[model samples]
Target: MSGPNGSETMPLFEAVHDQIASDEDVAALDDWLRDNPDGQRQYLEFVDMQHEIERQIAGVFSRGPDSRTENATSKAAADGFLFPIHSVRWKVFAIAASLLAAVGIGWWGNSRLDDKPIAAIDLDASPVSRVLGIVTASENGLAYSGRRKLESGSALRSGRVDLQSGSMKIRMESGVELFLAGPSQIEMNDPLQVQLVSGTVTAEVPDSVIGFAVKVPGLNVVDLGTSFGVSLPANGQAKVHVFDGVVDAEVERSQQRVRLKDRQTVLFDGTSVAESSYDQDLFVQPGMNRDAIPTTTGDVRFLHTPPTSVRVGQFEHDLVLCFKERTESTLLETDLPVSLDAPGHYRVKPRWQNFGAVPRGTLVDSYFIHLDAIGPEKRTREGSITFNRPILGVVFSSSLLKGQNEIFGDPRTAYVTDRTNPKSDPTLENETITLSADRRTIRFSWRIRSRSDQVRVFVAADR
Candidate 1:
């Protein structure tokens, strides 16, 4: 009942050393060790003393009972007394010491293992980027619908974004912003560079991201602290239009470089390059309420069965005018009003308010026209068209070129009228139309005669 201090109670230290302590009893011993540093040192010393006693008891047992008895007899003769070698108390003490020694050695080994240092982790070797941007907005359909779902605040990594039908906006970590139009494919190479594989993208690169580069098929467009637009169609050349500041474009194959300043435009088709006047109203900017009017130009032939209606941009233009076989007239009239939603954008409605089905093998003429959403202040209006099919000829007129109107199959190909005769050909004198190298698109620059007056675009096709 009495412990080491001669009190009428056993201490926690004695209970632990005697191998009679439960988990809760050992936990109490741990609390006492924390509050008293001298007590902790004393506990370790008691453990060492117990280990030494166990070692001595093991040595006596290993010598065997016969050897121990001989040694005890010699000691007893010298001391004039007999020693009991096989006493029960001595045997019990040896057994208890051996068990305690095994437990102490195991606990010491575990304590040594806990004192070992852990390996450190290096964060710089991580695979993920340090700062990632988020998707701000998305419209239409994503190119990679199965890869990952795109939503607001979705973190963007280095991957290709195929915008099949709509547009998307991204805000980068470096304060650079991008407005990507659909039918476009782009790759995020890093926070600083993006490769425009196909389609159109407008970049608003701030001062922080001045050197941001856009890699096209055959050229590298490096931003020089500016906002610019890059468009690359499937079959056409890549175009770089600089709205502000400067841009350096270099051909990858030829190493030919060109510097474009503010309001400058350049086109590179792998082998050749050309510069032109930058048209600001050509592309739709971010947050602009604009719509593209769809028109078809080039070889228009009547199908035996009416083809499926095609929707271009955001509107549905379903009315088809087909002329029947052996029809004397090549024209058909429609009463539908083609109303455009945007203010500055133009829409074409048939002059006649009646539409009739045309017979098979009838030739139909059409033209593709694009109107700018720019306001009236811009006196010079420009439009561009990329044909899906080959175009035989194109014509322009202030009024609808109805019956008896002059038509130009090959306009400006030859000098038909003298320069002095101004009244002879007034139509060709006012407007300037330039055709692209591919002959697929025609860029028209017209002087607006009146805001209320409408300009008509016509294309002639053979059956």
Candidate 2:
């Protein structure tokens, strides 16, 4: 392809270079490029040549000809023309200027015939609203804030955020913090209002954020300076749970209103709303408080701050400590094949592992139950823990625990696993295991030895 004056056959190339190609011209060019492979290659080569010419022309204007930036061919051409370097550049510019003038005349003639302005890139652009939010944290999640990956420091736009997996924490510019759990979809209507399409999202509104709202099916849950969680299932009704302060829930169709305060929740079945007691642990959202500790007795200590590592003999006291590890995350690999990914009452057995399968698209959180190995006493310990959520499975084998430590273990805490002693004993005869009928609690009695007795509970991350 060549310039309009350079060759009569290059009108299409000139129109494209000037950003003035019409729809029919574009269609014809596309068809030709697709049908002829050699033409496509030559077309690309022509484009590269045009770009290089454009670059050299731009340099002549921005940098004077005395700048010595032009190639040897340009210098040689100037010498052959028997003119100064500056005059040669001006001659090149004059030729380009005449070609542009011819293009303008052709566009003016077409515009008069068609009665429409040329749709070129020179048109003034329309304004766009690019709202942004800072992602404070991301945990095993894949999402997009606007057109970019939704990770920490991502700029969120005024559009829908699709959370494909795991959890994400975002703070709006208005001081509203959103804790999002996936497979979810949320639309940022503005800095204060959000629309929930499916899955779960929790918002903590500060005093500065006024009229913060979460819009779901059938109802718009508006915060009156409050924190709340909005959940909408794929094939079920919508739910709004208020953790603190007050909120006004209004139906979209009829504008029916209901005000809920601390510890109150509502279920909207697309028809009417039913008020219920708020269960804080119902949604396995990020930034949730795991205040529902189990009831324990003898040789058991509920740790508010967990010890640094789960290695043997880290603590001098011979007692078991229980703490919820972390919020729900996508389990990429399994330490031990889950025996009960579904809700059921069962006891863990040595051979039951690798016998069951975890369902696809499921998320799990872990709870660490560590029995600290004391000195040479080797005392027998008895303990029981009653959880508020359903247990998926448990891992007691030292080998399995070694694999799961980095997977589900609290990241702040370190764990020790020894490859040298892979064949060490894991189960004891004096140990006893019992899972209640609802599968929410487990009782354990282990014969403590020189090394720690560790068991990790893998539980469902949903209500």
Candidate 3:
């Protein structure tokens, strides 16, 4: 007679029996039913009992009870329902039995639904590619934007790596490796493709990754199993250099494609594209240190120049020597010991010694000497230094050595020099240096030449 909240629920029972409950009252009843599940089962049973009683009464009235015995049995049935409703224990038992029957029917219906077949579903059809590689090495101050910071052994996925400074290397899953120089942006499209937005990168593609491709601004370079380098300068020109094997390059706008073989190169601007022979010495390798020179022979001597002095009448010069053997080259520089009392005059002995059997092709030896005049005054001082090695190519910038001007040599030799006066203007001059068959040694002399405080001399030889 009382609810769990100590409020009478008799009003709720009367509203259900009348089959006319207000919306608010129905909502309240639903909440009450949730709080009291037993009450819900009892309510359902009560409603069924009321409907059965109404049917029985209607049947009796329709039949118009032909005899007193039928009328008496019908009256007794109606009275028996009243007795069960009044008895609390009997009402509980009847409600429980009805609830069990309803539950059993619901379970049977659910089982029938379960027996029906369902369409199969595939869960592994996602469209994401697998991881390709990891960042194997990274230089200090290596910053990246638009993605996570790149560190050693960081797993690489499909995304753009924008480097602000320093360099990094990536070891791919397909046995391909990449050395990405700083100030570069690259998008890892997949294991087979990369998009180079700017800067430079050297790729070492093995036989397993023959179809590896790099997409530049206006061009696409497809490797034919090669070690190559690609650079995109700020001017929007793309340059591709193939070290070994071959590659197919295509222009996106014109659909112009070309096959580049070993030691070949191509340049692609927005308006035009050009091809030429590759220069192996143009780029430094991945882990090479430009300051340290390599020695090609076992008995090679090392020299070092004293630190430039600020005192009057003091000058200094550093020498760098390069020896080429096959496709590889070795660099050596001066390693002189430091001593304040030591005389400025010193002799360097770099004898032309063949350490090993030279390959068939003409072997060339190159030397680069840099002189710096460090003194109290900014004015230039006259100085003279001599080299025993033949002078071949001379230029201010190394790029000028790419045959921009012919100075001295005829077509038969490598002794080419710039003929411009070493004074008048200190800029790079187009001068020529003559060579004799016995000219194994040469001398450089400066006489208070303006802006000659810093001079760089390049010497090359071919045998």
Candidate with the greatest TM-score versus the true structure: 2
Candidate 1, residues 173-234: lDDT per residue as tens digits? 44567888878787773555677878898888865344677878778889877888998877
**Candidate 2: TM-score?**
0.36
Higher-ranked by lDDT: 1 or 3: 1
Weakest ten-residue segment in model 1 by summed lDDT = 115-124
Tens digits of per-residue lDDT for model 2, 1-463: 4333355326787788777999988886777677677777777877877875543322112223223534542654454422222323334533443455546655323222121111111111111332335464666779875566765434465567899997887766445788888888887745556778788999988653446778876688998878889888886588888888899999877888999898688999897788865655556545435544555554454543344556654443434667667644555453446434444434455454444555555577677887665457665676577777677777766666677677778775667655535444334323566666787777776776545667777666764
Top-scoring candidate (lDDT): 2
**Which portions of model 3 show Cα errors greater than 4 Å?**
1-129, 145-147, 276-282, 288-463
Q: lDDT of model 2 at residue 101?
A: 58
Pairs of colliding residues, candidate 1: 324-359, 335-353
Q: Which portions of model 2 show Cα errors greater than 4 Å?
A: 1-129, 277-281, 288-463
Per residue, candidate 3 scores C-alpha lDDT tens digits across 271-367 of 5569855655444357643233222111111121111121112222111111221122222242111111112221222221211222223223433
**TM-score of every model?**
0.35, 0.36, 0.35
lDDT of 1: 0.48
